[model samples]
Target: MLPTTRGDFWAEITQIGMDRLWMQRFHVSLPQVSTVASRPGRRSIGFLTECNSSPLQHCGLNVLSGDIIVNKFDLAHHRSGADYHLGTMSLPTDELDTAVEVIIGRELLKSPDQRIVHPHPALMSRLLKLHKAVGQLARDTPDILERPEVARALENELVHVMVRCLAEGASADTTTGVRRHDAIMARFEEFLEANPDRPLYLTEICAAIGAAERTLRASCEEHLGMGPIRYLTLRRMHLVRRTLLHSDPSKVTVTQVVTDHGFWELGRFSVAYRMLFGESPSCTLRRPAEQPNIHLSRPSSLTTAEPRAT
Candidate 1:
């Protein structure tokens, strides 16, 4: 994952593995691209674990509190505006597929379309409590889960609630406008990735991606909460940091790295870099590489991130 916001990134992650399912909790700082890729044989879902927190953007739509997003056959993108607390659960398709069909009177894997399911408030409350309880148990009293019967009961209950949510959820299908903008953003990202080392012009990007400037701008604003140029600069600032952190000072000069990433305005680049990273490029180059503090994460080259407007 790439760092989207300024300063050092921080996060904390916790996970518990069951016989066939896994539950995870993530407390992350900064809004960065978080993706769930289709496993082909497994299914996954994520939700806001905290009460009344800011909504996470799922394919350009806001995923409100208590709402769940289920991943389908393609890469799914989720972006947050700032710090977020989230929980997730996943199991093999075959494991829960049968249970879901039996209880819901429908097949879970029949459709490959990703979905946002808003479970009824009362039912979702129970699910969230159980999910939160499970996470709490795993953290403070993991030995309690060592009991086979206890573990089995929890897993069974978890599955039951999951199925109930799916059965009762008021599902929202992707709108035509959202889908079109999502596709445009995807194409725009592909183009940027294809030409990583060069300074990109907006006109050139629009032409190559076959999107009008206005559409591309709108897509970026919706998904990333920033305009294209702002995002590009934010993206490169972090890229430069990544390179500096890894490069050997004896072998590489800062200039080579900065220019290589397509920045030519050395005068302004230094100021922006310091403003975003809270350090001089040379200082970062000299410091030792450090691991991310706290939670779970990574950003993509084409990943979505929302930076505050200047």
Candidate 2:
């Protein structure tokens, strides 16, 4: 994922796995945005647990604090505001489908699109507390999951609550305008992927992507929280930083790397780089290679239970 704003980036992620269920709680140290979807064979739910003035944009809609988002196995774009903490869970789609059939007797959702779910405040509170308790187990006492009965009990309860939220919650509808913007963003990303080595001006970007400038501007603003020009430059800046951090300073010069990423003005590039990254390009290149800052818990599974305590 590309960091939208600049700083030393680090993330703390705690993950837990049950027999057929998976869960994650993560926090990033930077203001950033990324798209997340269901894993290849799973259905996922993401909740923005904390926020203040700025609400998160989920699949092109504003998700206020305490709101949960359900991914219909579709690409869901989320932009987090500062002090963001997100919790997510996923299980096999078939498992969810069966549960909906059995419990709710009708499919909670039939559309394959990201939708927001607003549950009662008390119910939402209980879900958050339970999620937080489980995450704590993953971080501080993962061996607790080594107990078969305990793990099974927690997993079942979590699933029950999840189904209840889906069945009883008020699901928000995505506007036609939001869908149009989502399509535009898809094409825009395709263009970026197809031409990764160079920078294009706003006019050329719109022309190549087959989107009008006004429409593209609104799409970017709503989904990306920034103008097209700023988003493009910021993404490229992150790319340059990542390369510089990993490249061998002995063989490559900062000038070569910067120009390769499509920055033509060396002097102005250096200024902008320093302003965003808090360091000069050469300084970043010279630093020794360090381990990635992401902290991920080794996930636990219920199948491997330890011997019962005496």
lDDT, candidate 1, 1-310, per-residue tens: 4446664366657777777777877766666765455567887888998875556887677888989987663565677856688888888988888878778777753433447888999888988999889877776667787778888899888988988887778788776777778778778777776877889999998898888999989988887777878877777777887888889999999999999988999889999888877778999999876644332222100112222211
Q: Write the per-residue lDDT of candidate 2 for residues 1-310, one digit (tens) a residue.
A: 5566665566566678898888887666566777675678788887865544346777568777667888763565678755567888888989988878888788875664547888888777777888889887877777787889989999888888888887788878777888888888878877876776776889998998888999999999998888888878877887888788789999999988988888889899999988887889999999975654344445562212111100
Give candidate 2's whole-model lDDT. Answer: 0.76
Displacement of residue 71 (Cα, Å) in model 2 is 1.8
- Where model 1 places Cα greater than 4 Å from the true spot, the runs are 1-8, 31-38, 108-114, 143-150, 293-310
Question: Distance (Å) between predicted and true CA of 194, model 1?
Answer: 3.2
Worst 10 residues of 1 by lDDT: 296-305
**Whose lDDT is greatest here?**
2
Enumerate clash totals for all models, in the order shown: 7, 0
